[model samples]
Target: MADEKGENPVTVMVVDDHPMWRDGVSRDLEAAGFTVSATAEGVESARRRAAAVQPAVVLMDMNLPDGNGADATTAVLEVSPKSKVLVLSASAERDDVLDAVKAGASGYLVKSASVAELLEAVRATFDGQAVFTPGLAGLVLGEYRRMSTAPADDRAPELPRLTDRETEVLRLVAKGLSAKQIATRLSLSHRTVENHVQATLRKLQLANRVELTRYAIEQGLE
Candidate 1:
């Protein structure tokens, strides 16, 4: 996996308590031409190794020795803010999903997902898409909606000015359109669409597409 934000090949770190599962995931990622830079079995180890290696992605398991994945996720981002976490867990409980996302996870997948789905998810996560197991995505988005009950004019922070085209791009983003899909819909080049998205992100002081989408949804863009 090559990090689009940098020149070096992107590296991944696997954080899980089960050795066999961790090793198996590492091997699978490696077989898919991904670089597995480190592995950790607990919250402390995850935070420490993430600080050291600062991998591009962290394949996280919810159950760990020291603490749960949410704790580890917050700790890892504290050390390595650039890394994106994708939860690969056995649990599909609402609290687990929300906790992981709120703690800075970029995606969540149940352990039941096939290897092919996992591979595609990793690729999507690397590309900054907020991947989730089918129903989970809707649940997360609905939570965002529920959290933003107040009308934007009533409680929203003053938003920075966005160009009309940028606003259009953002609405599409809120609708879960990929950059490529947005480009096709808007009759623009993909690079141009990406540029618009990046510009929107910077102007809004957002970390990733997930935040961007939330912002858009809060503003009633979609």
Candidate 2:
């Protein structure tokens, strides 16, 4: 398997200042069938290791010894443009979350997330989807809305028409339902649900589910 950038899939770099916490999370990810390819503490180390390994996903912490996750995210991506960053932090402050997103993080998850939830978020993030904790998705969306700089017309993109099934799938996707859950809800197979999702993405000209979810929210489906 490969990521959107064609990097090896499930290969991750865990970035946190705390050794024990980082090691524990690395173990959990390894147990869940992911490859913990690299580990780093603080901003500089993260930047260096990410450049060297270019892992498919970067698991970042908000507060590092040298800088915050946002700083590290920007630096790492600058060096390894193909890396996908997912902030797994203890902080949920509005500014911190916004900063990380603005710095190009694919998603944000709080430390309180279960091991299962964290693993799933990592998978979604690597899939180029916007994975956030329960309430934080809404928070980030609303914040982006408030901080919009584009003209109103530019922000309101003209959407392409979608089939009824595709529309149903899009709504579930905007609500952050996984493909499996959508399949169960609509009495369709998972592959069928994914087909609908891919069809919708093609119709909308969206690159990934992250953009698809944002478009759905703009259309009041979220």
How many clashes in each candidate? 0, 0
**RMSD of each candidate relative to the true structure:** 3.4, 4.2
Best by TM-score: 1
**lDDT (CA) for every model shown?**
0.86, 0.85
Model 1, span 129-154: residue lDDT tens = 77778777667656666767867676
Task: Indicate the worst ten consecutive residues by lDDT in candidate 1.
Answer: 213-222
Off by over 4 Å in 1: 1-9, 150-168, 174-176, 185-199, 207-210, 214-222
Candidate 2 regions exceeding 4 Å error are 1-9, 127-129, 145-168, 183-196, 214-221
Encode model 2's per-residue lDDT on 1-222: one tens digit a residue: 355555655799999999999999999988877889899998999889998988989999999989899999999999998888999999998788778877888788999999989988898888777788888767765666665666776675555888889988987886688899999999999999999988988888888887787666556454
Model 2 lDDT at residue 66:
95
Q: Roughly what TM-score does model 1 have, to 2 decimal places?
A: 0.79
Candidate 2 whole-model C-alpha lDDT, 0 to 1:
0.85
- Residue 98 error for model 2, in Å? 3.0
* Candidate 2 TM-score, true structure as reference: 0.75
